[model samples]
Target: MRHVVAAVAGLIFALGLGISGMTDPGKVIGFLDVGGAWEPALAFVMGGAVVVYALAYRLIVRRPRPVVEVKFSLPTAKKVTTSLVVGSALFGIGWGLGGYCPGPALTSVVSGSWEVGLFVVTMLAGMGLHQVWERLSARGSAAAAPAPAAPLAEGPLKGVDA
Candidate 1:
C-alpha cells in the first residue's frame, strides 16, 4: 500500500517536472546563466515550492505528531560546520556545471538524453563517495573518542535523582 502510494506520488511529481520544463537541461542551464539568455521560469517554480512548504510546515507543526510518524525526525545539528560549507559548494558547482540536481536528473532520465545519463552516473558516484567518506569519518571518531561522564544532576527537579 505504501509502495503504491509512493509510486503514485512519484509519478505525479515527475509529470509536474516534465510539464514545468524542469526535465530539460537547457531550461535549467538558462535559468542559471543569469547574465546571458536567462530563463526566469525556475524562479517561479522555486517561489511556488517555498510558499507550499511554508504553509505545509505550519500545518504540520500545529499537530503534536505527524499522521504517519510518532515524532518529527528533525536534525540535531545547528552549527554551520566545515562539512556543510564544502557540501554546499560542491552542490552549487555540480548544479552550475550539469544543470541538473538529483530530482530533475532522475526525471530527465526518462527523456533518453545521453547528457542526463552522464549526469545521473556522476551524481550516483558523488553519493557513493559521500557515503564512504562519512563511514570513514565515523569510524575515525569512534576509535579516537572516549565516552563522556554523566551529568551530576538528574530528574525533573534540580540535584534530584528521583
Candidate 2:
C-alpha cells in the first residue's frame, strides 16, 4: 500500500539523517559557524544529497508518470518578486540562527532541545501569518477589482452559427 511505502521511506530517511549526524544541532551549528571550530562534514553530506537528487530526478523524468500519481505537479511560477526575496531571507535567517531547518529541526526534536522546540513554534507561526496575509490580500484585491465585459469577437467564425 502507498501508506506502507511512504512510512518505510520516511523511516529510511530518518535513519539516514541519524547516521549522517544531521540530527545533531551542534554538528549543524558547527558547520554554519565557518570561522571557529567549523566542521566540514556537513559539506560532504550536502554533496551526497546533491548527487542523489540529480540521479533520482533524471530517473523520475524518464518515467511517463510517478507510480502513485497521474502526472508530476511542478511549480509553474518563475517570477522573482518581493515575496520570494523576503521569504528566502527569513528562511535563511531562521536556519542560520537555529542551525536547523524543518527536516533537521524535526529530527533534533527527539534530543529534547528547547531551541528546536522554539524554532518549530516560530516556524508554525510564520506559516500561519503567511496564510492570513494571503487571505486578506486576496479579499482586498477582489474588492478593488472591476468586473469585465464580454469581448466582441471578430473574423469569419465570429458571427457564424454554432
Query: Which has the greatest TM-score?
Result: 1
Query: Candidate 1: minimum summed lDDT over ten consecutive residues — where?
Result: 153-162
Q: Model 2: per-residue lDDT, tens digit, 15-114? A: 8788888877788889888889899998888899889989999989899997887887655445565766887798888777767777777766777878
The digit string of per-residue lDDT tens for model 1 on 5-115 reads 779889988887777878777898999999999889888887877898899989888899866667866544556667668887988988888778788899878778888
What's the lDDT for residue 112 in model 1?
Answer: 85
lDDT of 2 at 24: 79
lDDT, residue 103, candidate 1: 83
Q: Per-residue lDDT for 30 in model 1?
A: 96
The lDDT of each candidate is 0.74, 0.73
Candidate 1 ranges with C-alpha deviation above 4 Å: 147-162
lDDT of 2: 0.73
